[model samples]
Target: MEENTDINLSSGKVESPSGRDDGDKFNLQRKIFVGNISYRVKQHQLTKHFSQFGTVDYCYVVKDHLKKWSRGIAFVTFQDKKSMTRALQATDEELMLDGRLMRVAPAEESKRVSYSEGANWQTRLPPSLPTQTQDGDTCESDFHCSEQVTLPNVSHLELDACGECAIQRLYDDSLMLIFSFLSVKEHVRVERVCRRWRHLAQKSWNRQHKLQFRHMFKGFIKGLTDSILNSLLQRCGVYLRALDLSASPQLLSDLCADSIGANCPNLTELNVSGASVTDVSLRTIAQACPKLRGFIQERSFYVGDKGLTSLFQGCQSLEHVDVQNNAGIVGDCFHSLPTTVKYLNLDHCTKLSDLGLRKICLRCKHLTELYISHCKSVTDQSLINITQNLKRLKVLHMEGSYSQITSSGLKKIGQLIFLKELSLSQNSAVDDGVLVQCAVGCSNLTNFDISGCYKHVTDLGIQALTRCSDLSYLNISYLSHVSDSCVEALATSGKLQSLVARTCSGITDRGTSAEPEHLDTSRSSVTINMYNLSMPHLKADREIMLRPADSSSEEEEEKEEEGGGQSEPVSLCHQSVMAAGAEITSDNEWDVNELDGFECDDYLIGDDPLEEERWSLS
Candidate 1:
């Protein structure tokens, strides 16, 4: 839930109610960090804007010391910590100052560098110098991880004239702030210190709402058991908000889901992609967390329409839902989706037809991001309906699905001016004229991937992409019609970062023929992967062969999508292999059994033979 931006401004500078002023102290503790202020905003204007919260003592806008350029950040100080607290209460609110929306948060303690009186350079050493093993480590350091750390012998120290303990004099909030900096292991140790310390440490644990299992265990998360999860959740209580198990493969099955549903009632975001959850688990989760906004149960073993329907009916406030690659979902499960949903992913739902999509467009009209990749049943009509209804759509990824979106549907897609990322990787109908319309229409386009559009999208369609000033990430791999000229034009765009041109036969044999050289890569940071090959027999899955280095062996990627309609290229590094049907040979017999895959660079040379008209052998 978003907080209200309504400011509680006061008339003028608030005088300290108790008549104690710390304006001369320059107390960094009682300060707030302000950001996104207009570059032209004066220091006094910032002070005036935040005067409603409390007494403003001083304000300073940060600048690049060398260039003297405004950093658009400011530090506002108050006479007391209460004023700082009042300002931080509106951390999520977009406070406008000088007609520009600004962000505010509690300022961290600042440490000044030793500098000369007039210069910014450090001319002298700082007040304190570091030596080895002076204080102890807070996190799981060497001594703590290797062996048990026994408490050291205590020595009495002098205190104030009064009988009060010196540490007890500090505010409880200050003590809790110190505890918040410690790691989870350190928190357990702090609890055994004393009664007061234990009480404060428990408060810190209860306030910790987000928990990622990967952070708790540095090694393989397979060691995570039900006992460990229940113990941690027992400490976090019902305040647990986000639970992520993406790193823990083969984690607790349905029982794990039941434990989470029973414990984490306040969960807002949950990812169980690595777990083996069933429809019963989803039903339990739906009944427990009604205010869930983002939920992901991708690549599940037993999840289907029955669980998804329960989720939509239970959590009406859901905004982001991803259930990709679950083949069990074959029915109209999208009709009950709430209007509040902004992002939806139904990729690899093979049986989903155009009717289910029509119902989605009619209900979730405010969708901004939609992913229906590898959903072959989705025809041109469903895509046209999406463009007509969802005007706020920004990121649409319908890669590798082989309904082949034609000009009528592509024309409707071009009208989506708000689109930023559009992935039409294997859609056969995205030809030269269709791409020209999209290049002219989507002015805000940044990421465009048309990797396997093949013979249809030539240099004419690719060159048209230069009109998109924001085009950054492009994948032109496997397009036989694309040439060096098209690649050169797009690289000069200055914004292109990742250009995946792995298997273009039209490219020259300059890089691959030599000892792994680059084609003018110094001009830009774009990773131009040009492993030019001519393997027409192989077929790649869009999601399977994307990040080539992720696969442990060749056999793992070849397991799925042999009978799919599209013949997409399987690209990963310099080598790729796609076995069609049961025709996949042994691991030793890839790419004619030579150097195999990316290693056989000599055999996989570019096929743009020198023509007499172009390079005449006179």
Candidate 2:
């Protein structure tokens, strides 16, 4: 019998005829044989091309035994037999290999001559069948075959079949949705990827409805001019609902304002705080944007009453306005404000007096919140007017305005049963009388601040505040008269979430502790006659330790020595009343050190003061 060359079709190698079972050889037939491959193609390149159909296990390109050059054939074995079947079915037409058409089919076995053993050598042929020439020599070319096969034309292939083929299949809307999550800076970086990605990123950026220029400081200094603002407004301003240009103060002028007014007609909210805007720019924006609802122009020195008048007269849909520190607004200009306004802030407006406030309360009946802190000219009459006219008021801030307001003003404030948040800090005349009135009527109160009113606030005031079942935030710092009794009263409220009582020397550790310990007075219980009749009866029974005298002050030491070395207890009298009387002369001069403890820093270090039954309201 003629020698039959046994070839391993999976590895493209020849083996000697042995007693191996036919089942082992049949299992190796799950590899697809690809032919007509170019000589430049490598094993990895072949595997990469075949991986698109299924997961390939191993791929090998057959080579000559002596010359070590490619034989223009390769075998690709898949992980499963199903992958081999799918690969054969998917490649119905000619497969492209490095710009050339190739043939793909099931691997088969054939006989061939092995060059390593000369004429006597017998081997297996690759996927293509070899033919013999008329010169009595065996060849590997298929030209001598009976049937002819033509190659495909390279120019007729699809253009997207080569580079980045996977990503090119995504639709335009899908691409836009993927790019919309990227920020402005990331969008700029993605534009350099390719022409298609750049087009999609640009389209998504142009459709943005909100833009904040707060972090573009360097760009504002170099490129944000009037022309740039005008160009930006002309491109995407029509779709913008919120625009924040507060950071670029130097670039915002009348020209930029005029461009925004002409282009952004659908804008509902605008922030130009700390910008160099004048009355003309304000009037232009107000006259152009009829749908304007919320405007913030804080710290703009050049915008006066005329601009405010124009804005209120033109924008009937206005609901919120913040013009803090605009000192040019006089009492007469408030008449132009519409009754549709609900929230108004005129903090630090020194020109506004009781007359202007009364006018606001009478005209804006729909107002629910008002902030007039540092308006020194406002007195008790303003609060009376607010309670009588603006029945819908809920939030009021009158801190730092105690020069004219007295305890009588709080009586009118208590009548507003709908009040939820009230801030009367730095008002020297607010005492327990005010708290008594508030507890009787203001049942809906949730937030109260009486910090700096050290004159007459005592434990009795906090005890009276327990009637407000919804009280959550309380600030009574700087009140020297507040003692452990006030803390005890607040602890029992069962709804306090935040409590600040710093600078109150009367609150001992026993009051702030969650679990109080019994005092150990058995060691130094001394009976002495109490000469100070002003001391409370309960304090006189407890053992008191006198503080040491100041050695740096010679007068204090001499006085203590003259009293036969007997130290006196420091008086617990109110510190604000003993001196020139606690008065806030300037808003900047307010002592921040006394109020810093009222923040959340202390709550992070020690136990929270309001940890039990604490709750917060919206």
Candidate 3:
């Protein structure tokens, strides 16, 4: 037997490790035998061709033992089981080498080789063959060939295959079986591996009836280079039914609108809140998206009468219009909307008076939900007009401007039996006299917020509101004059969810002021309180500050002292009654220090009449 030779496949060198072929014979993953190679095929060339499948680090073409001539055979050693399998799959016969095809198959055992020196050689042998001797020759007595073998036994081959071969040849039939048994969450994890996998994992975000644009409000238009915004609008505008551009001021401007008009013609829901838009932006939006149903404009976007006219003219399908924080909008804005307009929010529009609201009631008869909070200009007659004309109105919010609505106004609203939600908070003018009328008129009322109406909100107001059988949510906070009895009635009468009654001194069992501790302790508290008191009260509290009375010479001396300068509280009584509201006013001639508290003066008015003559020069 010739000693096995090893070759370095990467470098193509016939290199052998120390003590080769004795105790450390290389383990073969597949049977390795070489035969029928053309005479020109070199070991290096053969190794290079077969090593494409795996590492063939060692290979040798055998030559005649005596003459050392090419014997048309070679031994190839594969680096790993995978390489061995790949070689088997890739080539069974005629693997080209040196421009000549070679016949390839597993090598058969050498019939004449001796292996009898190894222990238990008899049991390891083929059934009829006996063990061989230690030398290069076989043991003749037991080595007789009884029958010819058909093929080599490759049943124990441990060759590892490449990915494509492993999946197609080894696992193709059972591939679905493996994944069919995995849990849903595990499948999701597998699909989250890369872009391709994520594409497979998610369902359609646009499959629903209405595309949800709420979550996209936060960061959709951030630093989007002008080109990108224009491109996106061009691509996605046609199919878009709802486009909520709320909170995106830059993207809703004139430039964006023009681009959108050229692209998005079917847009239905357009929310461009905080855009600070004028009639121009609205006109562009209305023209671009004629099918628009809902429109939302926040604080900065003042949708005056002209914008409303354009919107009503262009977007006839409009259903809801929210013009919040446009304090300058008069009643004329609502005149343009068709009767098809159902929902209107004019919250914080302080300039819209009763006249404008009456126009709204007359024109927008289909109005179901109306929010006119903080419209201090609206009066009871206007609200009466709404209750009488708009029968469909259900949810009404008139908080912060109660002076407009009196008891008679509540009586008018009684005609709308369909009323559900009502808010009268911060309307100090609404007393128990009117709220009882409201409770009687709108018996179906469910949600109510009646905060900050202190002077007039007595227990009678609370008792009347309790009459609503459907009442569930209520807020009666900050009514400083409301007593414990009102809260006790609410705790038992209605189903309240949230109530904010800050500074409601009368209802809270805790005796502290409802104002925040920080606000009460701040510098403005003392100043604000003294500024509102009567002139008689300031004279009564003479110890707090001095008052200038009748004495021309003493006054001149005090003026001289004041010219020298000192920080002093302004005088609260006597001569300066013109400054009744308690604003700080000190001219260059009247130094702040020369004012009442700076220095003692004989001209100072107080309970003691005789002390008015003594001037403290110090």
Candidate 4:
């Protein structure tokens, strides 16, 4: 049987003016009855209203479950003696409600068999608390994960006390500024110090926070769930400034389509180096992080022309881009990039050509460093255009088979005046005269590469380079006309550190045959001496195998479809699989191979084959 416990809240015992008891008893601590509340009255509403005069310790609204009715009274506990005194002084005897004079006087504690379990008040439980199961066992719910991970046995009072202890130390302006530059991982460690430290870190994070996720992709990706990120941001009240998602292009689409963007409005720096992201992903980034300043990704991340256009138009604040090995990026794409971009790396971009380079030099005037190494299609016109337009251009790299460039083109490059490093290796047109012209035009040149400019390069070229007083590193390897005189001059150049002149037939103290000698007659002989002499780092070697401009082979036809032309004849140095100092086989093999005897000497070394009739030039 349940207790039918009731307190006479209305009729409290009062003493007469003479100080005699009126036979009715009242207990101030047990209850101060306040009446006429509906069952719908929530604890938060009651506490808010009652706590105005004094701090409220607890508020309980009694309700009957069977009939779903309010008990018409609630218990309000004051924090201290002063609070109780203030409450009495501020209120009257009656609380008028529902057109009746409700009671507001202290009442005696209920003494029926037991206290009534009448309060239907909802407990002020933390969000991370466990839920009761059917077997009476408490199991943690998803919401409980955060609580379980937090300090044990922590209560509201303890939180308040701990928070107070940390307030003075954290609110110090100097400490706040000190945490400003800390990385995201370091910030996490600070927050885990103690309950007070955690609260302090949270306050600091909320006020002003920036996350440096540099090289943290592995750990971030492991636990980077939508729920966790959203929860952390919302609770901590922070905006992410730098989000280094380098090499995480695969997550961009998923993160954007979800509410990640809406939650992280302050994102600025982004790095996505290797995840082959497409145009759609870049567009998504533009929409999500409107204030984004820098974005980094590999070429495979872009989808098509639309992707390039979207990034250019959307990320107006963008300044730097590092796109390596992206074959699809063409010359036309330069027009889309923001003018603010100062540093650009299009390294190993095979499809990019001088036309695009010309576009970049003209539009992006502030560009200082341009890296186009291993981009085989760059020509003299492109280099000339860059030198003329970009006055501030400092470093230019055109390494790998720039054979089409002539002395006149290099002379034009000297116009930059401030050009620091110039690389034009494996070009058939480069010779003593070209080197002389380069040395005269660009006196500030510190680094130079005229490698693989064989046959015509002589000691005269080294004399011309003497004018470049600042020349630091020079590569003149495979220039068969160079000898002890040029090497001695380079050795005394004072600024020269590296000088590559390996396999230059002209460098021999004793004269050798101009014609290449045979290594072995057998085609499959692995031990052939000629194989050892095959030059390394020579682009002409690969070019020789490429089908000639007029070849009718299927591979050539395919290359034409891909690159859109039958290009000029290419000079090739054989990659030797023979012994050192071995001679090369006869040029007759050229007729049988896929690429026939269309030679670089015909167009470059000798007089114009076009000047004479088809038979006369030979």
Pick the TM-score winner: 2
By lDDT, is 1 or 4 better?
1
Expressed as tens digits, the lDDT of each residue in 448-514 for candidate 4 is: 8877767567889876887888887887766656777776666566576555555765565333222
Candidate with more favorable, higher lDDT: 3 or 4: 3
Runs with alpha carbons beyond 4 Å of true place in candidate 1: 1-178, 189-199, 218-222, 401-411, 488-498, 509-618
The TM-score of predicted model 1 comes to 0.55
TM-score of each: 0.55, 0.57, 0.50, 0.49
Q: Each candidate's lDDT (Cα)?
A: 0.69, 0.70, 0.59, 0.58
lDDT of 1: 0.69
Worst 10 residues of 3 by lDDT: 153-162
Q: Of 2 and 4, which scores higher on lDDT?
A: 2
The residue ranges of model 2 lying beyond 4 angstroms of the native Cα positions read 1-169, 186-207, 218-225, 514-618
Q: Report per-prediction Cα RMSD to one decimal.
A: 24.7, 21.0, 19.8, 19.7
- Candidate 3 stretches with Cα past 4 Å from truth are 1-226, 250-252, 402-411, 491-502, 508-618
The per-residue C-alpha lDDT of model 4 at residue 184 equals 57
Q: Please, what are the lDDT tens digits per residue for candidate 2 over residues 347-446?
A: 8888887889888988899999999988877888888999999888899998884677888887778888999999988777788999989877888999
Order of all candidates by lDDT, from best down to worst? 2, 1, 3, 4
